[model samples]
Target chain A: MKTFGGPVLFLDRDDINTDEIIPARYLTEITKEDLKPYILEDLKLPGFDPKGETTKAARVIVTRANFGCGSSREHAPWVFEVNGITAVIAESFARIFRQNMFNCGMTAIELKKDVIDALFSYQDCPDTCITLDLVGQTLTVQGGGREESFAFEIAPFDKALVLAGGWVDYADKKY
Target chain B: MGKTTAEKIFASHLVDEPFPGAKVLRLDVVMCHEITTPIAIADLVARGKDRVFDPTKIKAVIDHVTPSKDSKTATQAKILRDWARRQGVRDFFDVGANGVCHALFPEKGFIRPGYTIIMGDSHTCTHGAFGAFAAGVGTTDLEVGILKGVCAFREPKTIRINLNGTLPRGVYAKDVILYVIGQLGVNGATDRVLEFRGPVVDAMSMESRMTLTNMAIEAGGTSGICMPDQVTVDYLWPFIKDQFASKEAAVAEFRSWWSDDDASYDKVYDFDLSELEPLVTFGYKPDQVKTVTEMAGTPVDQVYLGSCTNGRLEDLRVAASMLKGRTLAPTVRGILSPATPKVFQDALKEGLIDVFMEAGFCVTNPTCGACLGMSTGVLAEGEVCAATTNRNFQGRMGKGGMVHLLSPASSIAAAIEGKIADPRKYLPE
Candidate 1:
């Protein structure tokens, strides 16, 4: 099984769309690697900077509801994957975007609105970290000398895709 | 147990039940466009599995950035062109004949009731207007559909939205759907299909119904569907005539895809349209909707009247009617693009193109250009646009630009006034 644990970046907003995740202008590039520097370049969040230190150091994203709405481009998730941000924790996600994350061997974890609010409490904690344990189906967040663990669920097929290192490998075995 | 329309289609096309509520289904059509398909093709080629499951069932288009904006976009088109030719995909639409994929595909009669379609583009839900189950997917699912003709999904639950009462004059399908999205909020329909029903939808033309469904993604819906009826049969009659004895026969065949009367729904909403007014989006999110009166007089730098949502002949006619005998405000730049070659030709034949040009509008070929800010009509920093496209997300038309989503009639009014204005004031009294 696969798991992820790393530094976290928090964006407190809803309906963060695909265009904001990876702007439409750069979609012409042929490779996933070409999409790295432009991830979240168009996002207009108050304190977030695409080129800042917080972005480069973060390995996960915690945001509010409907984290990836609008266009169904997979480049949004590919950008996250390339930047080493393999997990996005949100109240909910746009359906296609959630699936694309799993297809890339990345995780999109959904917690309740209240749980998401609690997670935001650690946003200002510079040392905050998130550890996603797929084997135990749990998410643990620790920072500011406080820690909490929450149970999470992933569809069996999505878990299988992640364990198999994404859809390409899973399909290679099945087909 | 009664079944929703989506559930019925899923049951018929099911190849396997992966888990309790997840289904593996056989797809009827796999649509591809240059921007997203090139990566899938490259991956398949690298794996030595560059083969399409069924060439006849695939429809390819080079649309997003046609006439290649840059060397990179040119390379993207070449990959799709070579792959389609190698696979013998006859339905491919290249630059001269190409339009926006969502608009062009349906114009060619590629979609039908009960069919299941998948495309890498989010507006693939627009095809669901024909009572089909169509969803936008990602590269992995597109690759699987191309290679194996199969895709997996969680079995769908549906939300039935009943559009009741007659629409007041000057109100259009775009307004009604915007109202619905405003009420539901962006995430209200997440992971669910929206079945649009009742007399209002029944009265809408196929083109109008398509406009309603095309924005399904704006509300995070899997698809937005209307039960196939006589309007659908009449719209498709020319292409389907040889397959059926009569239009009624075709209609009868399609009626089987309708939801059962007792069908269970996750939720139901009844919207009264008698009080409806033209609507527009004021913020980056599509759900941030307000009445045209509430948004009037907001200065705009551009007015774009096209995209799959509002680039059809009906949209052009409505916009032309408003622009007749009126020129755009000197401060506003107006651009119009018909959705397909047919729409463009028909608009020309009907003098709609002349009306727009005479009104100081620049007409371009059918590309999904400015809708996604790829080439034509791109907005500069801090500029604002009144557009008839689906989404109004931040920087959708260009970096640091703001977009206001509205109907074609409203868009033309904004062009003439150089600000957001209600189209009803210009309507024939």
Candidate 2:
């Protein structure tokens, strides 16, 4: 299934490595099903199953700068995929992480300060309604039904890949 | 115009054949690790491609996930193993067979003179030890390399580094690179090619040359290349003896790309070799280097003395000599990974490994392990490590692990005292 739909996961942390999301030990397996278990086990987020598991319903994860900071391991997004994360929203990303995320059919968007805060507050307040209009470059948030909007920048190269349904779809056409 | 190996190859491969100033060119060798290879393969499979464009041109290794630490790493290795077997890749060294790809690729003859090599790994530039034009590429771009045999190419500007005097007693090649990174800030060599030339370079073993070129990536350069001379020929002769057949032919082929005596160079950088000391990087940045003497008393909990750079026999001997009859400090974790099977065997024969193990150096099978964060020797939280590997990006070895990059000499010195220190204290007078 194309995991465009999501229940956004608010993982509040600083500098989460890809290994934590998808333990590097899973990278040897040919099937994603084998890697689905043990997702984020190393990170102490024990409940998230990498091989199976609402983590599946959550296609979007928001995080802080230097997010995905570590080895050039692609297991990060593979775990995200096996766990059903189709998009990653962050304030910043390690270059390698961004590439892996895109390669694995996940959309990683970088939102500005206010937009990030809007998402955080929405998760924090619960009453705050937030929706990311990635195509329009605007993030709208409503608290007590009051709405606000902010624009986000997506690099042209990234936009081409993410918007095109990720690497498999892109390589089919480009390569 | 001054010519860098990258520029020369770019011109050779370019459709328009750009001279000095040109746009980014196609890449040659596309490097990939377990971390990025899965996706690249998925993309390839989704497209129904049976095999890589040319398996001979690709170089794959399992350095990133050595010792198959946990289930996750083992899984990564499984996929890598299957893929390499399926693809008939010309060079696919099992993790323990070689320590680091950057060092092993050249040692195994995967990197040849006058050829262009590309890797999915950022440190692909390390293969330039044999004077090959190499570069790092993204996974997607690497996929492109696999689909089509060649990568686009444009020449890079040239920077000539001339080492005029004999190296100081304790200063090794790692110190030379650290010194270069210090002089030229982190981004000093952006898009430029660095060419090392001097009697010192000509005198260096091929392994040492790999050390010089391996760290060129840290300087923000496109790639680094050494002009092949007799030393290069002698080192590679044994491996390609059957391929090249005649030593004379091999030497002739090597001499072809050397810059002409009046060869134009974009910039000429001079270094007085005798002045360099054993340099140790105190922080994540390769440029965050200071002399070993200057960093005395700065404690380190871990000391890693191997990588693509300085994991060769000579380096092992130098380190073993430092550890003979000396026990590593209780607090320090001293680790060594020989660059290749051949290097490891040489070290074993020379009794270097036994000395190291007896002195408490944690020796592991050859693989990129720990250096790039896919191994058993990861650093614990808030722990500071002195390593000889290239690239000290934040949390490189492990989460929240602080790495201070150092030459093998400094790494041994630090291991002995559990702090970054001068190798002279442990060196033979």
Candidate 3:
């Protein structure tokens, strides 16, 4: 399984819908490359810009409840992946949005609401990092010489797919 | 233990006894539209599956960006058309050929109870109004359906929403759902299915039930289902043919699909609709709903009446009845779109189209247009619209614009007054 870690960029907001992730106005663009630049531009979401230094520096996004709500556009996850966000830790996710993240080979770690609240308390802490170990099914948050590990859940099928680099690869091998 | 409606349907489709996590299970129907099908077709070809397992079981429709709003979307639609034709898909609805997939498929008698339906659009839960198990999936999941006639699913717990008491005048299924979503919050039903039960649900018409189920995703529900009843049989029988020639015969065969009396549920919510009023949403999230009386006189620049939600015949009738022999306020621009071609035709035949036209409302063909800011009637800067479509998120309808979601009556009343107003005043006594 793939293992990765990166500095955390926390968005304490709840119900960050797909429309704000990648607004439908940009969906008409044919390619994900073309749509990438417009990701979350409309919302002006904190720390989410393809060129912003803070967004470029962070690899994980932490948000409270309903990280990917609203429309089931695959482009939402594609944009996040394009912007170098490999993992999103949230209190919960709308099912279709979570499935799209899995399809895009990104990790969506769901921690309890209070756990997310605890993570948000470190929002202004510089150089905070979160590490994800897929095989271990855990996310480790570290800042100021303190580290905490939070357990997460992923079905066996999803684990295999992520290990195989998403469903296209998984299906190619299985079939 | 007795199974909930979601469990009952999933259990029937399992090749073996079900467990908790993902498993490849049978699919009765797989549907997609222009926006999602291109990705699925590309992924299918990349996986060495040049054709589908069962083209007859798949339905492709071009409804989201219909009539080719631009060269970009037009190219995407062309790609879907070519791929669907090459695969010999039996139920492909090209641009202008039908309306939205969610409304068109079921209206044409494709959806039925005790079956599992999968689609690439989040609103696919709209079909669950027929007592079917339908859930939205991503494009990769759609690829699974095309290549293998099955998709993986992890069973979800069921939440029972027991709606009781009679609906008050001017209150509709839209109001009921809006109220439910407001109480539940957007994440209340996350990772779960919602089974709507009790007398209020049973009394709803088929179209009203569809409206109820269509917004299930707004509250993060995997799907929402109401048990099949006489209303379901009556609305679907004319467009369908089976051994059942009469309503009694159809009900006898389909009624067994309902959840058992002793069914277990993970959570239960009780709502009384007796005092419900016309509802409207003030902010971005659908859960930001309130009674129209509380929000009356809120100013608006435009009004849109359509979507998979609130674009059915019943919704149109409500709007038309209110706008008949009246003109929209000169400052307001309104667009009234039916959900399906059949609905548009029926509205036209019933003179509802003329009523809207006389009120200076732009009556357009069925599409998900403008609801997602895709095409037609897009909002301009700093403008606000009272719309009947689902979702009022910032810029959902256009850039720098606001969307306030309301029932058709509320939207129509807003258009007539150029501001949000109580719809009850316009309802006939």
TM-score of chain A of each: 0.96, 0.77, 0.89
CAPRI quality of model 2: incorrect
lDDT of 3 by residue, A1-175 (tens): 3445798777768898888888887777656677767767666564555456666677898988888898888888878777777788888888898887776677787888888887887777787898888988888888877778888887776676678788666654554
* Residue B409 in model 1: lDDT: 88
Q: Write the per-residue lDDT of candidate 2 for residues A1-175, one digit (tens) a residue.
A: 1445345666666556655665544455656667677566556443444333345456667676556654445556766777766777887765556765765556677877566766777664434444666567666655555667777776555555666666545555643
| Clashing residue pairs found in predicted model 1 | none
lDDT of 3 by residue, B1-429 (tens): 788888887777874322346655689999978887687787667657778878889898988888987888988899888988898997988866769888889887888888798988889989999999889987878877777777767787889999999998888988989999999999899878888999999999988998999999998998899999888988888765565778888888888888888988989999988988899998889999887889988999999999999888999998888888899999999998898998999999999999999999998889999999888888997899999888989989998889999899999889999999998888766
Residues B349-371 of candidate 2: C-alpha lDDT, one tens digit per residue: 88898998998888888877777
Choose the strongest candidate by TM-score: 1
Over the true interface, candidate 2 deviates by an RMSD, in Å, of 6.0
| TM-score to true structure, per model | 0.98, 0.75, 0.96
Once model 1 is optimally superposed onto the true structure by TM-score, how far is the C-alpha of residue B97 displaced, in angstroms? 0.6
Candidate 3 chain B: 10-residue stretch with minimal lDDT: B15-24
lDDT value, residue B333 of candidate 2: 81
In candidate 2, stretches whose alpha carbon ends up further than 4 angstroms from where it belongs are A1-175, B15-32, B95-98, B152-155, B242-248, B260-267
Residues A1-175, model 1: lDDT tens digits: 3457799989999888999999999999899999999989988788899889889888989999898998889999999888889999999999999989988788999999988988899998999999998989999999999999989888898888788888777766665
DockQ scores for all the models shown?
A: 0.78, 0.13, 0.61
B1-429, model 1: which lDDT tens digit per residue? 899899999999998775677688899999999998999999999999999989999999999998888899999999999999999999999989999998999999999999999999899999999999999999988988898888888877899999999999899999998999999999898989999999999999999999999988787899999999999999898899999999889888999999999999999999989999999999878889999999999999999989999999999999999899999999999999899999999999999999999999999999999999998999999999999999888889999899999999899889999999999989866
RMSD, one per candidate, in order: 1.1, 6.1, 2.0
Docking class of 3: medium
- Select the stronger candidate by TM-score from 1 and 3: 1
